[model samples]
Target chain A: MGSNDLQKQAPNIVVWVLLLALPLWLPYVGGYMELGSRVVVLALAAMALNFLLGYTGVLSFGHAAYFGLGAYGAGMTIRYLVPSTGVGLLVGTLVGAVAGAIIGPMIIRLRGVYFAMVTIAFAQVFYFIAFRWNSVTGGDDGLTGWTRLPIHLGFTTIDILHNPVAFYFLVLAVFAVAVGVMAWLLRSPFGRTLIAIRENERRARFLGIPVDQHIWISWTISCAVVSVAGALYALLNNFVDPRALYWTQSGDFVIMAVLGGMRSFWGPLIGAAIFVVLQDYLSSQTENWMSFVGLFFVLVVMFFPRGILGIIRRKVAS
Target chain B: MTQVVLFNVFNGLIVGAFYALMALGLSLIMNLSGVINFAHGGFLAIGGYLAFTLMPYVGFWGGLVLAPILTAVLGLIVERVLVRRLYGRDPLYSLLLTFGLAFMFEDGTRFIWGAQSLPYQVPGWLLSPLSSDYFFLTGYRLFMVVIVALAVAGLFYILNRTRLGMRIRAGTLDLETVSVLGVNVRVLRNMNFGLGIYLAGLAGVLAVGQLGLQPTIGSSLIMPSFVAIIVGGLGSLPGTLLGGLLIGVASGVTTVFFPSATEAVMYVMMAAVLLVRPRGLLGEEGRF
Candidate 1:
């Protein structure tokens, strides 16, 4: 029984170990601290998306809206309202969550492709706001001049700015908390109810589960977690732009979830890691990296639909 | 003030016509195949670029006629090779596949045509205003409206009159029933996709005449098409058309009152429609 339990825990252990030690080993493997931070931030976003997409069987192609809102929220809060990092992160998460909650009721009734279409369209509203609101959003130039401030804990001060390693740790710590909460939620009874809906909504509805409400909750939770990742992303770059909320960015998040194996908890993280690394390498190698990245998406959809971890799991099971 | 409003309203009509053209194509493909074709815009860009490339050989009129046909052919090949495999699977796969294709198309166009916006030469006679009094009514603008009206009429005629169109409508309503009654479902879907892409191509060619040629042209125009589909109504082609024209005019009018809200007014209208009527203005029951 202990051995069986250890087997189940093996992947989790390896994932945490690698993530905690990313800054240590990344430099030796031709990777920088900023890249490690990017991978973690994106992975968090992908995992948050998978919460709704994989577990709840809801496909939101407009998650970039929430992600962007969180980014703009954090950046704006820091730049205009307050200079504190904690406040920025809090405001960012709340803004995205509140927006998701409001939008959820209107869209929860839609299923499949219609839901996707509405979400994508709704995201454009925010994009245009950021694009046209020149004074506030900085328009096409993006919101600049605000840097993530150092945390002021009672005992100590961690200077996230001017220290790449420190910033990476801050990103990792936030990632850990967000991922931990998601993991906890997925293991709860509420999570099982979500899975039931994903597997067969009609049956879950027949069982009196209130399917739409469950989906609404799931969608909001997913948006909130993704916003947390978005806040971290703003802090990492210290710059936020409308591009962060673009539909293509949403597509990137979706691809990460699918490429890593959406069904598994750790799948999107693996997917994000591979995608971030590949994108970094490709952009450096050629100007036509968009084509290569697009080609990668095609290859994954056609051949690797079950994702990398999915293949491994099947092989091991067999 | 009146002149400004009238000019914008006229401008809105032109933009709306483009949206309707693009939306109609998108609606046709979506109704039949269940694929969103995020690459629809990419195909539109291809249509424009193709016309641009062919102009040197075929002249402006020849390019206009040939480019859309050529674009339709490419669409047929793409549907067969890439989009056909994922028909019965989750719609997500197809959406992603096309999303990837959109990226490729944008990059490919930039690579071939250079990222800088290129000049597309229209006939010199069409560039002149029809009259000094209605100076905004350039011959080209009027010409575009006539072409769009003719294309729309032709589309309706085909849908109502032709056997292929009858088969397409039947397939959209119930593919399994249509197949059981001896229609080749695959062929019907393939042809319908080609028809849709043909429209997108046509929109592309006309769009370049107004907006100029750029790789990013398709992406910029696609959102309005989506809004048109949503506002007009799903599963109703006429609704798509009305939705397009309405939003176009609405935005155009908004420009006179609040310029920044020009792009935003349509979205506001869409949200209002969705709030009041979730299925949209002319959307049928249970389509969502």
Candidate 2:
């Protein structure tokens, strides 16, 4: 029983070990600290999406709206309201979460393609606002002139602004907490019910679960976590743009979730790592990288729908 | 003030016609195949580009006639090769596949044609204003509306009177029963996809004449089409048509007043429609 339990925990342990050592090995592989931070941030977003998509059986093609909102919230807060990084992050998260909660009731009853279409359409509202609201959002130029502030823990200051390693660590720390909460939620009874709904919604409804309400809660939670990732993303770049809220950006998160193995806990992380590295490499290599990335999506959907982890699990099981 | 309103409303109707054309294609595919076809806009771009490429050889009318047919052929091939494999699987795979195709289509168009927006030339006669007072009512704009009306009329006629159209409608309601009744469901779906792409192609050709030709043109237009579908009601084609025109007029009117809110007004209308009727103004209940 103990050995079996260890086997189940093996992927989690490996994932944590690799994430912790990313900054150390990344440079050796011709990658940078910022790249590592990006992988983690994107992985968090993908996993948050997978919580509702893979676990709850709901798909949101508009998650980038909350993500963009979180980024803009953090950026604007730092640029206009407060220079404190922590406060900006908090406010950014609240803004995204609140928006998600409000939008939840409007879309929760929709299923499948209709749900996706509405989410994509709803996200455009935010995108256009960011694009057209020139005075506040900096219009097409994006929010600029604001940098992520250093942390002052009373006795000492962590100069994350100047040091890439400090910023990477800070990102990792937030990622760990957010991932931990998601893991905990998935293991709880609430998570089990979510999985039940995923497997068969009609059966779950017959079993007396408040399916729509649960989905709404799951959707809200996923949006909040994704918003946290968005906040970190803004701080990492110290900028925010409307492209972050575009529907294509949401597609990226979904691709990461699918590429990693949406069914597994650590799958999206693996997907994010591969995707970020590939994108970084491809974009550097050519201007036609969008075509290649699009081609990659097609290939993955056609041949690798089970994802890296899913394929591995099947091989092991066989 | 009334003249300005009239001008904007006329402009809105033209824009709404384009939206309705695209939305009708999208609605057809969504209803029959249960696939949202995120690459619909990409296909539209292809149609426009094809028309542009064919213009030097065939002239304007010839390009219009041939571009949509060629685009429909491509659509048929795409459905057979890529989209057909995932019909029974989760809808997520198909959505992702088409989303990728959209990226490819946009990038492909950019690579083939320059990224710079190109002029789609209409005949000199078509460029002139119809009246001295209402300069906005150009001959080309009027022609576009007429073509849209004819195309829409033809589409309804095909769906209501043709055997293939009957099969499509029947399949949409119950695919299993239709297949059991010996209908070639695969062929039905493939042809349905082709028909839908034909409309997108037509919209693309018409759109370039008004908006000019750009790689991002399809993506820009796709969202409003989605809005049109949602506002029209999911299962009903007529509802989609109404939804498209309503939003177009709403945005046009908004342009007359709050210029900045022109793009946002349709979304506002959509939100209102969803909040009050959820199924949409013309949408049938339980269709989604």
Instruction: Give lDDT tens digits, candidate 1, residues A51-112.
Output: 99999999999999999999999999999999999999999999999999999998899889
Model 2, residue B50: distance off in Å is 1.0
Whole-model lDDT values for every prediction:
0.94, 0.94
Regions of model 1 farther than 4 Å from truth? none
Model 2 CA deviation exceeding 4 Å by range: none
TM agreement with the true structure for every prediction:
0.99, 0.99
DockQ of every model listed? 0.83, 0.91
For candidate 1, list the clashing residue pairs, or say none: none
Per-residue CA lDDT of model 2 for B1-288, tens digit only, reads 999999999999999999999999999999999899889999999999999999999999998999999999999999999999999899999999999999999999999998999989989999999899998989999999999999999999989999998998999899999999999999999999999999999999999999999999999999999999999899899999999999999999999999999999899888888889899988878876
Predicted candidate 2 versus true structure: per-residue lDDT over A1-318, tens digit per residue: 599999988878888898888877988889889999999999999999999988998989999999999999999999999999999999999999999999999999999999999999999999999999999999889999999999999999999999999999999999999999999999999999999999999999999999999999999999999999999999999999999999999999999999999999888998999999999999999999999999999999999999999999999999
Q: Give one digit per residue, the lDDT tens place, for model 1 in B1-288.
A: 787888999999999999999999999999999999899999999999999999999989998899999999999999999999999999999999999999999999999999999999999999999888778999999999999999899898889899999998988899999999999999889999999999999999999999999999999889899999999998999999999999999999999989999888888888898889989899999977
Q: What's model 2's TM-score?
A: 0.99
